[model samples]
Target: MAKHSKKSTNLWSTPAAQVLRATDDTRVEEIDFSLTPGFDGTKADAQELLAERGQVLSALQEKLYANGRSGDLRSILLVLQGMDTAGKGGMVRHVIGLVDPQGVDLASFGVPTKEEREHHYLWRIRNELPGGGKIGVFDRSHYEDVLVVAVHDLVPRQVWEPRFDEINAFEKELVDEGTLVVKVALFVSPEEQRTRLQERLDRPDKYWKYNPGDVTERGFLPQYRLAYQRILDRTNTDYAPWHVIPADRKWYSRLAVTELLIDALERLDLDWPAADFDVEVEKQRLANS
Candidate 1:
């Protein structure tokens, strides 16, 4: 599903990733998770337009980490599914802490280890991907191995039902090997996940981000909304697509995931990597130091 070309500068007006795209007529009971579709600003105008797009998303993530240190194989993973107080660690501390945490690679998949359940649940998600031109993020991924192993049967519907075509052929071989995945779910309702788990039990500094198993996983919220509407109906893939975001307005889901990561680093039309050695002989040897 590789046809993504839409970046003639847009901060919404139908760009919150194609208004939260998860098609095949996505109807997770008609999502209104606190509706803010295509945004009409205000949470102080989306925090002053996410602080004016954080200097164009930190100079397009430092020109995609300097074109991946000049080797440039391209990258961008970003998965982040949801539930339990669904703000995926406040979208990783406000939209991946606005980049350049050394080109970002986050990864946060909890509860597997024992050599990750003895391998092959994408072997610890292919050892936390993100390499060339980084920006990986997961936070709760591998679609939580088919939504918490098919909502708590933990594994057995003929082994998580052929893992939805082995996660769409391992995300179409990670977009035929140049990465660029970007999944996202974060719907969040159940009255805003019960007022964000009661404001994380009435905030004693959010009491270490409270988790009494997120109040026993909120009594299986209708089996996790029928296992996230069958994982947005069998892995909504158009070369790795799935955007659902409402997320009960945590500042419009961190300004729609910071405009879906600045429309995926402005559709990778990245430049600024020239200079293989002699830029006028290193400016005449640093102008005679």
Candidate 2:
């Protein structure tokens, strides 16, 4: 019998990091354990994975619609964060497209307005939280406190450092208040990202999506990675754990996101509220009429 090293055993047997990678698109080929009926992106079954994901989303949308009719008031907040060309928008389009538009809201946060900048960092975010019985999606969220602000030195180091705790506490409060918080950080490799960016530049219609500033941002990929690692390390709590989705393959990214969302909504145990009746009064009114 041959003896195996502990590290090798852990890597091969565990779901730990096999589905995700620190700096490569290879892991996009692996099955995401976080999703049921795990389908690896590189395989031919990728289309099947997406189909299953569609079913789950459809079911979730039905439940949400019924809950809304009964005034059950369930709120879900989905936060998506990633570097440029990481498929944030694409994930949103594919995964949430089937959901009832009335029951869902999508907010994309960009550079703050002058008025928005006047208040505290979270003011803009707080104003956007979902009301009862609705799903709110944030394309890029308050994590900017850690990502963009840190990258550009927009704030003092101490100010941004403490925001990790602030964010965790804030999310905990939302969870405690009957809101389901789902945070997804899409991870894509630099090489894959370069390809996507070049595609955008080459296509006339997609030229709007390309920014000269993105070229500048590409230079600071390492710093952004460090910031993201720290963000994940600090903010990944049970109340709002971050799902690091492998986003090199847009199809796989959408499928994984849809599965995770379905799982979260299922855990809510939502039900349609029972109706109240005033039978005697209704009968009397009917007879009079």
Candidate 3:
């Protein structure tokens, strides 16, 4: 392993992520996704920033993996929630995709299977949590139980109400067990989403992504907004914070997420695990052969 200087991160802080991070002081309703933090550069500039940040992210992930290779148990799990066409797939492809897939555990939750419906909502989530030294990304996570279930009235309010506390408790458990949980809500403007959806209809290659149900989902934005507001308010805890990303602009969201993950990984100050074997002796033995 080689040592890499930590210089790339300094350029990535622009479009302040603090405003997007939800805290005890945050008002989720006040968040405006139309203007998110990020550089107002040309497309090329955005690509350059992503490439640089990707390098830093990849290095940090490698270090996290190295630490775990020797038995350290700290890891990260990123929970992403957003409306359809909010760039969740893009985040996976461009951001987390920069790291080694073997070290990354990705799960996308859709309509629950008949079996998943029989157990606690968090059951499947627990199975997918990142192990020691890995990075996990959830395209749509357990929050669906609250957001979709509440919005669609899949479960009664009484049943869903306790879940807010249950979710908080579950996240706390993850943090106590040494997994850093990061929940993100990608805020895509309805107008931008319309444009994306329209593009899918117009482009034959993208038709596969256009689901007629999306038209119905679009009608529930107001209800979903209320659901998300409560979700952010009730579930934001000190141990596992939620970051609301402004996702109208694809480039900015990708940049913001990359910066967020880099910040989290960098704070760990992960060091390369020391070689477990005698390096010089092994080298000499190989030379003799």
Candidate 4:
């Protein structure tokens, strides 16, 4: 197990907080999100990173399964949020693919149904929370209340502003109940996103991923950028912190995520369930037979 040094300083206290506070679009762009250590998927060999991440994920899954059988009931919820072509689906498919399918549930939130829209924003999300001994992956999560809704102005400032607190409370409740929430925002540069979107348009198999609507959304990049900053500012908590991953390099992103998972699971001293035997009862039953 890798021993990570305790985080002596809060992320908010660092220079990253200055970037988060910058509301000016030009100034925000100056913030370097690539400084974090991990796989530089773009420059590094993709196959090597994939193999390393696979091994790490396999270990985590084994520990989780064993812990489940021992009745420890540890739950993990991973929230993946990013722009189109940010590799959210790919991360779920590649990094977590090796995990026992039965032990994990992947929830992808799309357009809300009429029933879902009728209730509070988090109503549908709460229904899908992972039970004890299970892992839940959210392709895009309730953070959208702040991200997309904020970008589109689908809700008023008064309505969405308060959601930050509501979300914090919701996550706190989950963590208090033995749920380990790991929120990840995959950050892909506009240039990289453009390249991926172009590829989607050019490739026959990926054509389905391209839409005129994406161009419309791309126009609101500034708004989404602001919304993303707000998400990092408000939702990052001690119990359920967010990891901002550089998604320009998909392999590096996967490695960083796998390392994060391993780090979390290592904190829980999991062990296989012990065997129990009733020697006297077995002997009596045998004699009767």
Q: Of the candidates shown, which would achieve the greatest TM-score relative to the real structure? A: 3
Candidates in order have lDDT scores of: 0.83, 0.74, 0.84, 0.73
Please give the lDDT score for candidate 4: 0.73
lDDT of 4 by residue, 180-200 (tens): 888887877888888988999
Q: Which ten residues in a row have the lowest lDDT in candidate 2?
A: 11-20
lDDT of 1 by residue, 30-114 (tens): 7888988877656887787776776677778888899999999888888888887788888888878877799998889998989
Better of 2 and 4 by TM-score: 4
Candidate 1 achieves a global lDDT of: 0.83
- Per-residue error for 289 in candidate 1, Å, reads 28
Summed over model 1, clashes come to: 2
RMSD of each: 16.9, 8.2, 2.5, 5.8
TM-score of 3: 0.92
TM-scores, each model vs. reference: 0.36, 0.82, 0.92, 0.83
